[model samples]
Target: MVSGIPWLTVLWATPTVGAALVILLPAAQRVLAKWFALAVSLAVLAITAVLAVGFDPGGEQFQFVESHRWIPSFGTGYILGVDGIALAIVVLTAVLVPLLIIAGWNDADGQTGLRGRSVQTYLALTLAVEGMVIMSLVSLDILLFYVFFEAMLIPMYFLIGGFGGANRSKAAVKFLLYNLFGGLIMLAAVVGLYVVTAGSDAFDAGTFDFRAIVAAVASGEFVVNPAVMHLLFLGFMFAFAVKAPLWPFHRWLPDAAVEATPASAVLMMAVMDKVGTFGMLRYCLQLFPDSSLYFQPLVVTLAVIGIVYGAILAIGQTDVMRLIAYTSISHFGFIILGIFVMTSQGQSGSTLYMVNHGLSTAALFLIAGFLVSRRGTRLINAYGGVQKVAPVMAGTFLVAGLATLSLPGLAPFISEFLVLIGTFTRFPVLAVFASTALVLSAIYILWMYQRMMTGPVTDGNDRIRDLLPRELVVVAPLIALLLVLGVYPKPALDVINPAVDHTLTTIDQPDPVPRLAEGPTP
Candidate 1:
């Protein structure tokens, strides 16, 4: 294997490099701009596919690692890598970007200044955001990871404000302020982590490397006062919680989802939202194992509440997009539950959920965009008997809806089952409450599907057509993946299992010995 040039770097760079090429096109050439963006995204997709194919499932350490010291004195390095967990997400982002580009081809930005010129900006910003998010996911160095984490906000901020629907400006501002506050809090914690590790020659002037921090903490060599560790942990947790957007921190999501363009919403909910849970997995659990163990109960409690609360609100929604957004909130709760349970199965299941959820949710959002573009409304009541006019579109919606509800033999079913089974070992009561969410999900997804695709045809929609060839091109891969992974999940599970073992081992916690039935402890 190449010593320093990690394959994951290539995955991260493919998009950025593609964005640069797209930006070189003349600003006025809208068609060229659109095609070039498509070409670039396609190229990135190819690279990520290679990464996925070449990734070794047997190894326990990060694959395709590229590491070099960038700031020698401060001990910061430009390090990048991905294990099974990171690989899953990196690929998911890759899979969704091209579909998003196609979804935006109609340019539903309402009022337009540059006509299709906005497409160029949208393409470039999306590529940039994808690169940054992948970097954050794979970066082994703490400071480098933080830089990637914060950089993503800039592109998303502009995308929301410039191309979003009515009240976009306000939604954009709220999104920025919420993230900025959480990021500032995280920065302070990083400083605290540095101060605690200062004087170790291993890090020179205290390195901001994530692996280093974990090593120091686990070995008990880098001594931060217990109270100090607790404080720093909370700071990190707050930032991630805001990102995972658990419960009270979730208000920004609905408004943002409602106001942003559908493409932007896909990126935000599918890719960006993963960052929150990613933080908890990459930083919080690794850096503060004790604190994580300490906070398990409370975290699980909140997650359960979110699962129930978000599901209730989703069923009650009249707006289809808003309903989808609430579904995500409930999904996030399940993911959080898996994380805090500290089981290998739970962790791996959450990681897999991150990947599958992105694909399924992107399909739902893009398909929703198609319907709205043709019909000019997102209201559930505004649609009916659309399947007669648009059989293919209705079928795609059914697949996505079933995927969302985690129906048996679907991709989501495997992951959700794993999460509940694994979490139930530790917190049976919480697991039961969370399990009821599956029934709730069926309610909302099928209800929405029925409202839109069943019943007598409406006057205006009678002439509406099925998914165009172009729309099929955008949605086909997502539908196939749901089936492929659902039928044979061993490929993904192989990549995930090794890294999950490493994560559990590194945390130095007891292996989660799952109890199949209630009985005396063995």
Candidate 2:
């Protein structure tokens, strides 16, 4: 009833239906497959835009909700809805996918591997992954969310292994194994959560509905031993942290990023990786607020380490893709820090950062793909003075690089600033430490740009062409969004802040008072 339009169903079903259509297409009709995939993605994007217009930012409850019984005995249902947070991410997913389809239109065509099935296979898997991602974002039932969360890996696995670099198989296996292990651990927590919910007085026995669980927890009808609860919390937290691919747990990302095609990397870094951080906000804090507070120090410490370590590693990278991957680790560190700080500004900033990072990172990956396709290499020193031969590509790459560094007039700067300010209000010393990443971020981005785009034109670079019309089409929207979001972020903030406030209310936590500086002798 929130939107009275069954918007969530349409959003999820569009991609699923599209994927089925792509699979049914004639095997030889690769062109038809690409067009059909793009059309499907565009349809989803249009639906998401409509949903955004109808969304009531002031409302604190889930909107566009649809629920039907799927397993009555287990108290689970086919439920879907979106709060402000989910709404933003769902839209981001919708937007990026069409662009990804356009960017990869010819990437898999005539590729030697895969027995010439790369085009149809790539399109089908992409649509399938889109459906799974949207489902994960909107699912209101814990069981349903878990299903979508785990199922997402299947298509991504194929995308990485089937259509990537020489080492694609190895990267795909590493990615699957890491996520599979995380999912298995979370399965234990899911079962334990179900048991705990069944015992709660506030819920029907065997309920797997997230809202029901939240109600039980809030009302104190669901109780467990503190030690048991901490274990449950850790189980969920570990899965999310690994997904967030937080430090120490982040080893697989560089390999996967280096091996994946540019479009696939966008899906991994910009969309799929977001699932982890989003899970932390949705599951960890909401379901286990006490444990969240208990472990705040530990999580914050890891975040600080990720910020510094990721930036340092990025600076040392020789491969362009690997460097971009390392930068995301640093950016994600800020996101985790903001979430654990538990301030309104921090949470909102973190959410906004998710959207901003997706755009900026997509630009970087896609533009870098253009460069690699031209020079046929991913090494930083492969070619130089590229700006001389390909001015447009150089400009686009520089803008993306600047955006990654969160330049003052770019989209990410606002969110990064908010995270630091919010963190300072709660943990001044930690804020000071986290802020050091800012300088490190600048060094890595500028260093990469200088090495890759500056200096005299190298031998192979002389033949490199500027971005074609199709390539321009691929990156223009993202660049435009970065500029628009940078200047006028209020619309997004308005939608995000209320949802963050509602989340805090659910956990009965208030924003900490900012520590004010005192005047001398006042």
Off by over 4 Å in 2: 1-4, 112-116, 517-522
How far out, in Å, is residue 519 in model 2? 5.0
Over 1-522, each residue of candidate 2 has an lDDT whose tens digit, in order, gives 254678888898899889888877777889999998999999999999988998899864798889999999988899988999988899899999999999988878877665566788899889899999999999999989999899999999999998889999999999999999999999899998888777766765877788877777777777777787898999898888888888879988989988888999899889988889999998999899888989999999999899999999999999898999999999999999989999998999999999999999999989999899988999999979999999999999999999999998899999999999888988889999998988998999998889888999988889999999989998999999999999999999999999999889888889876657888994
Candidate 2, after superposition: displacement of residue 414 in Å?
Answer: 0.7
User: Looking at model 2, which ten-residue stretch has the lowest summed lDDT?
Assistant: 109-118
Error of model 1, residue 20, in angstroms: 3.3
Q: Taking the tens digit of each residue's C-alpha lDDT, what string does model 1 give over 233-294?
A: 89988888887789878988988888888988999999988988988987889899888888
Best by TM-score: 2
lDDT assessment of candidate 1: 0.85
Q: Estimate each model's TM-score.
A: 0.95, 0.98
| Clashes found in each candidate (C-alpha, N, C closer than 3 A) | 1, 0
